[model samples]
Target: MAQQERAIRTRRTILEAAGAVFDEYGYASTTISMVLERADVTKGALYFHFSSKESLAQAVLDEQVPFGAVPEQPCKLQEIIDMTFVVAQRLLTDSLLRGSVRLTVDQATPPGVDHSGPFRQWAERLIALMEQARSQGELLPTVQPRDTVELLVGGFAGIQLMSRALTDRADLAHRVSVLWSHILPSLAVPGLLLGLDSKADRGLRVLSAVPVS
Candidate 1:
């Protein structure tokens, strides 16, 4: 059991090191030696966990899906909003997530690595919530779940990139709040909008409430 736990910790260290390197230098410039130096792990240890740089990049992208996820809300729309904000908050400090987003949007990624996985995972998750919101009458009658999901995903991607570039994401939460304010009016019902909380500090509140693990 102790050996397994140590192995798990080692893998996490390598991933985080890789994430930081990738976030700093991007996929094309990041090399195994760089990751090894950052991780302070033997070549054999890294190869045991990840066969190649492409595989490591893919793992970093894949691992992002589970980080900083908010607890489900009573209103699916609110849940969706919380989901976005929590990620926004985490991005202020989490290099793994930043690395994942950078890789997903980086046009220079190696052809062998499919960076679409995180986008699809987020789309599918949001689509399910949007469909539920529609059923619960939280969405506008004209709002199509798939289309709305696509817009939300794409809009968040753009907003996050802009925030990263402009302020290194110092104001990402505010930008995300602005995004929801504009988008919700078009997609949500009037009554639902009144009940929704799209404040800039919503992410802080949500993170504060989450139990430390």
Candidate 2:
């Protein structure tokens, strides 16, 4: 048990170090030596945990995926949107997560390794959440769950990319709100618009407070 605990801690240290380095100097410029130097772990320990840098990179990517206990009961569409925004905020605030997001966006178009699993898994979870919302009559009858999932994921990805470029210039919340306001209304039932609108307003307010950069 002690051995396992130490291994886990070592792995976490490596991930944290890698994330910081990646954030400081993008994937192309980052090096294994830098990761080791940042982590302060012996080369043997790193090699023991991960066979190669790509594997370590994959580990870093895996660590960033949002996977926590969600509400047991069905969540309102607005609630889900708020939760998603909160997760985004966390990612934006976390240096490691921020670096991971940058790396993911950079590698999304041109795959170098097998780090896509986390993304696909994230998309799948969103799709499942949408389906749940649909079953609860939270979505409009006209809204296609799959399409909504695609839009939400795709739009979020686009915003993440934009956030990376405009890290110091753009407010993530405002950008998210603008995109959400435009896309959300169309995805909800007529009577549900009021709730969503309120949520969007709140989301906008919350996002406005998030510092750019």
User: Local error of candidate 1 at 107, Å?
Assistant: 1.2
Q: Estimate each model's TM-score.
A: 0.97, 0.82
Task: Give the least accurate 10-residue stretch of model 1, judged by summed lDDT.
Answer: 64-73
Q: Tens digits of per-residue lDDT for model 1 on 103-137?
A: 99988888888898888999998899899989999
The list of candidate 2 runs beyond 4 A from truth reads 67-73, 108-112, 197-213
Q: Could you give the C-alpha RMSD of every candidate to the true structure, in order shown?
A: 0.9, 4.6
Assess candidate 1 and give its lDDT.
0.91
Whole-model Cα lDDT per candidate?
A: 0.91, 0.70
Best candidate (score: TM-score): 1
Give per-residue lDDT, candidate 1, residue 193.
89
The per-prediction tally of clashing pairs is: 0, 0
Give the residue spans of candidate 1 off by over 4 A.
none
Q: Candidate 2's residue-wise lDDT over 59-96, tens digit each?
A: 77777665222343345576557655655666655666
